[model samples]
Target chain A: MSGRHRLRALGALVVLNGLIPIRTQPFYVVYLLASPLSFLFFISVLSSGAFVPFGVTGGLILTMLSAGTGLQSDMTHYRQDLKFQDIVVASPVEAPTYVTGMALSELVYSTPGLGVFAVIFVVTGLANLQSIAVLVGVLLLVWAFASALAFTLATYLRDVRETFMFSPLISLGLSVLPPVYYPIDRLPHWAQTAALFSPTTYAAQLVQGSVGLYSLSFGHALLDWGALIAITAALFLVAAFKARWKEP
Target chain B: MASAVVAQDLFKVYPGSHSRTPALDGLSLTVPTGGVYGLIGRNGAGKTTFVRIAATQLALTSGSLSVLGHDVAREERKIRERIACVPQESRPLYFLTVEEVVYYYLKMRGLPSVEARRRTREGLEELSLGEYRRRLVSQLSGGLRRRAMCAMVLASDAEMLFLDEPTTGLDPIARREVWAAIRRASREQRTILLTTHYLDEAEALSQRLVLIERGRRILEGTPGELRGRVRYPYRVALQEGVAPEELEPYGRVATVEGGQTLVFAREREARELARWALERNLRVSMGPVSLEDIFLDVVGRSIDEDTPAEDAEPGHDEAKA
Candidate 1:
């Protein structure tokens, strides 16, 4: 397909899966924001405002990561229940275009929650011009990596029910266990080393470093950005090119 | 006069844990452009597999299949742009209204908004779905949801249309509406490949039909030509209490469900048997041989008996090929 036609398909799919569903009901935004805000509230209460920045930044990262991991259920439902993916495969839209469109729809669905986190981050003086730029870049990478991984996993599922429990477990591993809501240094040396295996650890470090929530050397900050980009690019390559688009 | 789809020595082996099952075994046929071509087969006889392979949604294990004169494996992008499919397993997005479902589907297929809207409106009216255009698909009946799916594809400008059991869930009146819409699409010089279990539907809509059994082509001809190939020219269905031996002298006798006996014979013998049955105050009906009779003769079983449960239920067949 030509670039223009692919763009049209992408735009239409985003509207179909994202905007129309929410617009029709208009109450789903509350559901979208509930998880992240609740986490923020509990974390703030436990720390007595001492770790407000961590809570705010973690809420932002969690919201973005969920957008990608949440795709596991959405895509499995589309492929297994609705069979809409079959309809999409038969169209002029290629596999990468379809995956990207679906990923963007998740981002759109999580926008309201992300906006809430952004407001908190700015009001607490944790976000400046340079920090906001870095945060946006990091969140996009997190979203991209999470979406690609989730989409690849979803394709292997024979049943949609598998995703209901599977996706949240993945979210806990990728986001919760990787220092996304806590400082990496708080873990023992060996535990911190293992956390580096997850892309979210790097994402959290970069955002915290830019916002002055974590003490970091300039060299360390650059390394975090490079690692996050490489991990996201590698996964995106697999999702766009090697992921299964046809049944075996 | 030109072929829209041509498959040569098509074969598909579905990988299983212990033993590989073959779905299509050396199945071959040529579907002519600008007409309704019916693929008639029992459930799991490779009808869905062929449509999926032709539509580029599934790859064949080993075969040479082409759509619109392009290789299916290599030129799938070119083929996809020209063909639209309403897969039997597909359902409309329930969150969207019937109108949005059709309109957005056209847009996703690269139509401009104005053109997509125009075609969506036309398609809805053609299928008698205009009344439910604004209602969510989740609120519609099963038949209406099926109609919504048909409208999504029928509104497109694709040259080759693959409709797999497009009328399976519709009522008689709704089925006729969809058939009319299909006829209109065919009249626009588009090629339609339809797979169906309904014998009457195949006879009514298809210009030519291909009957397959156990993943092989058993017969291929127009409806009349296939009927002509049947050795028996007439069929007499007798009510219960008739012995199989009683009709054996006339022609082939088979006891069907409810103990009803079906006899296939020449018109003279068939008429004689009918008359004898009627004289004895028995219920008997005689008619010209139908496509079903030919199918039973060639495949050695009735289509309804061979249709698997998965084909009737929506969620049973998880595997696509």
Candidate 2:
């Protein structure tokens, strides 16, 4: 397919999965925002508002990561239940374009939830232009990494019900188990080092550093960005080169 | 006529997880460009596998295949660009309205806004789905959903269209509509590769067809040529109350459902048998051998015997069970 057609397919998919659903059933946005907003609410209440900024920052990353991980169920449904994959594979649309389009559609679905987190960021006085730029960068990388990982995993599934088993497990592994909603220094030395293996840890630390909730030297912040970029790039390579497009 | 699709000794074996039988074992045929070319087969006879491979949805285990003069394996992008398919298992996206499903599919195929809308409107009208155009596919009946899928592909300008059992769930009227659409496309000089086990459908629509069994070609020709391949040029079907032994003296006799006895014979003998039944006041129908009889003669079984229940429901009049 030519680049223009690929883009057109991508745009159409986004409108189909993202715009159409939200328009017809806007109430689903509540379900999307529930997890992150609840985490923000409870953490703020439990910590007596001392960690409100941390909660707000983590909510942003969590919301974006959830959108990425959500691709598993979306893609599995499209492939298994809807049989859209066969139709798409036969068309002029390339696999990478299809995958990228699906991933972006999920992100678009979470736009309303992301908007709530943006309001929280401003309310917490953590919305400077520089910090916002860094936070946006961190959220995009996290979303990309999670989306690539989820898309690759979705191809291995034979049934849509299998997604129910895997999507939440992936979300917990990528988001909750890391230091996304808590300061990394709070963990013991070994636990903190182990968390380093997850991309979400770097994303959380970057958000925290930008929002002034956590202290980080320039070198440490640079390392965090480097690690997040590297991990995301590696996952995207797998999604692009190794993901299943044609059946055996 | 040039070949639109050519498969040379194609073999497609599913992984161990799937059925042990090879989906396509050295199955080969050439589908000529323009008009309808039917791939008729019993259930599990590898028709869908061949269409999937030719349409670039699945890969062949061995041998060479090409579509529109491009290799299926090496030139998938080029092949995909020129062909559209309504696969056997395909369904329209339930979330989109029927019109949206067709319109967005065209848009995704890179059609401009005005052209896509025009074709979408026309496709829905052609398939008699215009009334359901604004309804979500989830709300439509299975037959309507199937028609929506057809509308999506039929509206496109692709050179070759792969319609795998496109009218399997449709009623007789809807099936005729689809047949008409296929005919129109053929009149426009588009090659349509259709797969169905409905003998009447294949006979009415396909200019040429191939009958396959267990992933191998048993017959390939025009309907007349295939009917000519049968040794018995006529058939005499005697309704109940006829003893098989009584008809054995005339020709090959086989008992079918509802206690109907089918006797295949040469034209003169068949005429004598029909007259004999008439003298006895027995119910009998005699005619030239049909495609179904030819299929039974070569394969040693009725096609319905092998067709799974879900492939064609017994309740539908068009099922011809």
Candidate 3:
């Protein structure tokens, strides 16, 4: 395929994903928000509610998990085929640069889903002017952290079957143990403390705080965002180092 | 001429579940700066492992390898900058088009957009892939995808090129086209190291050939030099009246028909034997020698001969390091 065609295919996928929320009604919205498929679905459904902090938290968690699954699949397939390593070694491209391109592509691919949720919130009278900037910041943070973690985990995966088996297990454990669907105060003190250690919990908290769905101190939200970014950066470095460009 | 590629006592060992099996064992060879070099080997003879290490896509367990005077271990980036490789059974990114695949490599090599475009166009034209430039790689046929891959490597403008089984699944015509392009590339001063199981291909293109069996170099010479080592004279046809036993006194003979016989004679006696047969009122014909015959003599096997099918996998050798 030509370069232009590949880019077009990616653009088409983005547009198709973006239109899903705009054309659907409550049934589709409900299915999206409650399903474990992708966080974007939950975010789209929750955008219709005036005070749905849990929905926003659920959506953020879902987005991270979905992105993780996507990264894991890509990494696993590449390892099994060995084509990725062959291309990297044969071409002049460096491993880190190739990974950076993949990350950026993920960000671009995720834009439409995030944009659709933004539009839904605006049109449904769910998001006020005060929360729009915060919503955008949370989306960016979720994407960066999710993509970085996926890239890092990919370094360890040797095949697609392992990735398929492992990613959902990790996502499922994180979903049940963290503040994705319920507020931290409602959980046991120890569970809440443990949730604090999960990156998805911080992301969920930040999304809820931004949309006015949950009551949180701005300082606490800022700290969560900072921690997420730092973790993403550190994971990125480790992934770059651990990637085996040459076969051993 | 300076050597384009050099290796000394190269070795590679894959850690097996129970114990390590050496993939390459004290293997060493050199290629002159120009012309094609063919690496011929059986399935488990370590050809792929050798190419992988030479391409700097795999690390050796021991020994030194250099390409264009750059050591593969320490000067990998420099060596990579000057070399291009077409790996066996490699495919392009599923989402990328043929043009994109070629352009991406050029861009990575620090070529400007204009130069990248120029090279992509030239490579596509050379490989007859210009029409498929806009199609997704996932949509192309096997042959076209292979062509696109070759174009991608060609666009890199590397000085040395290594192609591992470049025509493995290609049709006869497609294989010829690929060979033509390879010849053109060589004319432009690109040093090519090709590995193929096809004896005819090796004879047609390679100036020097190396035959490896079980991770060890068994023979290294020009096709003529290798062919010269086989002293058996090719047998020709004879009239139906000649009995097979009559030719037995001349050499080892096998009857093909009532009158015809195949005789394997020493190089010195072949001409005199043919003359003697003709004097006996037998119509005689002579056969020409080929690389296939020489390969059989040296390896004690034929490509067409069936061994246990399970022996197709590469065999393990002792690790040099």
Candidate 4:
């Protein structure tokens, strides 16, 4: 493809992915509204076959899928034509600025999913007004976390084929092994402790508990937020180190 | 005047799956403060790799590189501030307009909004791209896209500019225009380091030329000095009616084509061969040799012989530039 056409497609795709949610499943919607613990609530809805209130699960799933696809596109298609990293290396723009700019762009593209979840939650009486606001705030954080991780991963993988092959496996492992879809309390003590190492678990826990979908102490929520910040910072640093702006 | 660029024992080795492919094998060269230097090499000759490292876009596997007295490794940010690059096969972001691309680069260099916009306007006008100021880069044709990329670097007010194959796909007229722009930039005292397969380009524009082959410096001198290195005596082109049998009596004849013959001798015997060719009424063309022919003789390969088909022909797009 010509360079211009590829870039136009990238811009369009960014806007499209940012604005639209992947699935309209009722449980997915409920999962978005239940902040940190929505993953836990999603498991309950999946097990009970009950009406699932829109909460964090839906947002997390949407974010994971979007981030995965976004990263794959960057690796496979964009890398061949555009050395976006050249801009960072050649200019004074540091890794944080580059990652933050990309994340904001992706956030703009992914905002519609959160908006849809918020509207559905309020209209269905599945979530209270206060919870919906907190859910929206948490969903923004989730978007930030997803975009950052995706950008970092895109830098590490050498090509699209490798990213495409590896991303889903990593995402699935992170999703299932962490406390994303269920409460840590439901698992064995060792498993619960192990989940703490996964950023997604902290993100999922924060999303579920903050939105009132699941009960958690304020101190636990604070701890999750602190861990999320630390993970984001570390990933940004790793991206700066591993980013190969020059042609291979 | 301080050197615009300096490097010592610059080396870059790409680690392959099993072994390492050395790109820049201890290459070292310097560009003076305000002149155009042409780096000529075949594809995969490490020309692009050298430019990338000097531009501070790539890290050196070993060796030291400095731009405007700033060490690339220790003072990357300072080095970056002084250099602008139009990387090989690169373009501005597809979604941004021509003006936006220029403005964004200027801003990255810490130009204020007003000055950035002013510089953007001037750069576009200089390259005759003012008409397409509002057009998105994605909307431009291939040649124009290249011009826009060039303008971005030019607009940045960088002291040292690195252009990797700047005129690869441009048509003759566009190539001249781009060359004129480079000359103008050089006149403004910006040091330019450019690479191209177009030997005539290197001959016409460069104050000094560095010819590399197999990751080694094969020749380096002023274009005229390199041209003078061709010891071959006389190049004789015959008319279609001339026969090779008739030309063989004068000197050893190498038939280049159906009608063209090249006669070689020592420099002292060059005039003698020309006289012999004329005595036979064989149409003879003689002149100071070009860098192209000299390069072919030294490297035993022609730059145009095996150029990849996908590389756009020079001057294919006009609307964008």
What ordering of candidates by DockQ runs from best to worst? Answer: 1, 2, 3, 4
Error of 3 at A33 (Å): 10
Ranking by TM-score: 1, 2, 4, 3
RMSD of 4: 7.6
The chain B TM-scores of all candidates, as shown, are 0.92, 0.92, 0.82, 0.87
Better candidate number, 3 or 4, judged by TM-score? 4
On a 0 to 1 TM-score scale, where does candidate 4 land against the true structure?
A: 0.80
All candidates: TM-score:
0.95, 0.94, 0.79, 0.80
What is the docking quality class of candidate 3? acceptable
Error of 2 at B277 (Å): 2.7
Model 4 agreement with the true structure over A75-97: per-residue lDDT tens digits: 33344455545644575555455
- CA lDDT of B34 in candidate 4? 91
Per-residue lDDT tens digits of candidate 2, residues B167-262?
989999999999999999999999999999999999999999999887788899999898788888789999866777888888888556777889
Q: What is the lDDT, from 0 to 100, of the residue B236 in candidate 4?
A: 45
Looking at model 4 chain B, report the run of 10 residues with the lowest lDDT sum: B312-321
Task: Give the interface RMSD values of the models in order.
Answer: 1.8, 6.0, 9.1, 11.7
What lDDT tens digits, residue by residue, belong to model 3 across residues A23-128?
A: 4332432332334434434544666543354654465456545655565666556644536556557655555555545555544434444445555556655576
List candidate 1 segments past 4 Å from native. B17-20, B239-241, B256-260, B271-284, B307-321
- On lDDT, the leading prediction is 1
As for DockQ, the candidate ahead, 3 or 4, is: 3
Listed models, DockQ each: 0.64, 0.54, 0.25, 0.20
